[model samples]
Target: MPKGKKKTESRGAGLEEYLEGTVFLDLWRDKMFLGQEFLTWLYLTSEKNNHFFELPGGDGVEAFFENRLTLSHGRGNNRRSVAITTTEEPRDPDWDEAYTAIGNNKRVIKGTLRVKAENREWRLTLPHDTLSPQGVKLSAVKDPAETDDLGKAGKFLDKIALTAELVSIVDELFSLFLSRRLSETWLTEDVPRLKEYLSSRT
Candidate 1:
């Protein structure tokens, strides 16, 4: 093989093993709800020279949920949106150095990974966010008015339901990311496991 091809194959093999290991699967199993949590970890480590929660303030996880009834009645956007932000403070100065080097070089990274739900189907999303010098923001956008509600009460109830779901998913995903075991192959293998875990709780 050519030198470049040989290097590529070697790295690919190592990543493959990394994916199959228990460490990866366990992490996937934990953060099954917040879909992009694992990607956040990988991005920070590789590009930012940081560990999960490595920033001075550590990681911050936030979820936002809106309900239509509250908005329609209260006079506002009448739409619901959920957003989560996770921030990591670097404990080691070395991490800061690495991040500075990568950012200055402006490297582009691309890959695919799968996240499995409790229903035996994998949920896949483009696991990327626009990176700013400050931190990362994860957002889910959906129109709240699209929900079928007969009246104000119904709309209120719907909002509550949506918020509850968002909270639950955020909690699970945040916990998983903090544990630091998420890897590409493990997420692919644990779709069914995650589904089972979520189903049991619900």
Candidate 2:
């Protein structure tokens, strides 16, 4: 087998395990509703501020939902993918439409994300199943002209490292969400507030 093919297959296998295994599906279980709450709350939170939030030991970043969202009701009802942006018209998609759907017991299953950290930016589509980032478009952190071959290799490695750090930031955000979700805070605070946020939407 070619070295590149082997590496590709190995990565594919790992992603498969991550997606289909008990770990991710356990979170996806209908009753838990962890994914839905996390996303809905995130959308609400970002709207109230400049979307500025910090990960532990990291400078703050501005992050927001990037149009695409998937919402589902248990079964029999067809799943929906929505583009929640102002520019996509004729469709005229807005929160009120989504709010109505989810109110009928639908839940958000996926969303694309945009994050700006300092001068660097990243765009990723996230499936709630594993919180693994997909279609990750990352900004270059180093100027190519400043580097020789070995230095270029090191800069490439640095980009990979930065990519991992950026994606892991989502996982940390998930952890923060999960902590709040599992607590009574979700019911006592977030749920009521989520209802208000939904109602207030256009």
Off by over 4 Å in 2: 1-32, 56-59, 76-96, 147-152
Clash pairs, model 2 backbone: none
TM-score, each model? 0.24, 0.69
Residue-by-residue lDDT tens digits, candidate 1, 27-111: 7546443333344344343223222222112332221111100100111264232232223332232333323322333221212
Q: Write the per-residue lDDT of candidate 2 for residues 3-86, one digit (tens) a residue.
A: 111235544567666766557555556544566667766666665455777654455767777666666666445654554444
Each candidate: RMSD:
21.4, 8.2
* Backbone clash numbers for all candidates listed: 13, 0
Best by TM-score: 2
Best by lDDT: 2
- CA lDDT for candidate 1: 0.33
